[model samples]
Target: MAETEGKFDFAIDRGGTFTDVFARLPDGRERVLKLLSRDPQNYKDAPTEGIRRVLEEESGRLFPRDQPVDTALIGWIRMGTTVATNALLEREGERTALLVSASQCYPPLPFPCCWPCNNERISVGLRSHKGRKEYDLQRH
Candidate 1:
């Protein structure tokens, strides 16, 4: 039977609260690294430092001294983010329009509603509104 050769691999995970890493070398040895997540700034620096440490430790574990490691191999990257949702929640979403039925244009305006307050709450097409009629909401 042919001798099975081992492989080297690395994995990093960044979550809302932590960063985790795992690395393995051809010699069947592995290393795990973890660090607390710092919001905003850490998002940029933590991964880089984690990768540097992994490389240093992996080099010593598999290729002691001046050994040339293979440079060609499979690599994977996966990223999940909540930045968009956060931005929207922060009221940074794009300007949006609301379409309300003409008849119910203004019903005392719900307090603290998601729709914009500065503009007319109700909007309808020319044909429909023309055929129908407009009544003073204040009177009704």
Candidate 2:
């Protein structure tokens, strides 16, 4: 009753202040766990610690002292980190992009609409974008 291990599929997301763990067992049962992204004593191992905690839950055992989950039984594992979001929030992300469109708009930009455009129905089909067959960018 204290220890269990089996095939599982897991996904991990490390946000700025939290680490989320989502797992699906071979029996079709699913679980989600969240842990603090940062601890007072250790900052570098936050993600690892969070994962270990989730694994402990999955195996129904206390980790480090108890046997860890069997990685070989894992079917798939996907993970994501918030380093990009953190960088952008801290104004340290790269700013390089080109946004171009092969389309047309009547009112033009930077102009105020008479609240008509604000209407969802009016705005949804506001753009009279022609069919793709006639789509082109000919700078005349």
Task: Find the candidate with the highest lDDT and give its number.
Answer: 2
lDDT of 1: 0.50
Instruction: Quantify all predictions' global Cα lDDT against the true fold.
Output: 0.50, 0.57
Residue pairs clashing in model 1 are none
User: In model 2, what lDDT does residue 94 have?
Assistant: 45
Identify the runs in model 1 with alpha carbons over 4 angstroms from their true place: 1-8, 39-44, 61-140
lDDT tens digits by residue: candidate 1, 17-127: 676777665576777778665645533445445555565565564432234434342143334445444544565654333434445556644323334334354543233
At residue 131, candidate 1 shows an lDDT of 66
**Every model's TM-score:** 0.38, 0.49
lDDT of 1 at 14: 65
Worst 10 residues of 1 by lDDT: 131-140
Give the 10-residue window scoring lowest on summed lDDT in candidate 2.
118-127
lDDT (10s digit) by residue, model 2, range 20-129: 88877767788887877777565345545655665677678565723454566567778898876577556564432212231433344332221222213221212234
Candidate 1 residue 8 Cα shift, in angstroms, is 4.5
Q: Which stretches of candidate 2 lie over 4 Å from their true place?
A: 1-6, 40-44, 65-69, 93-140
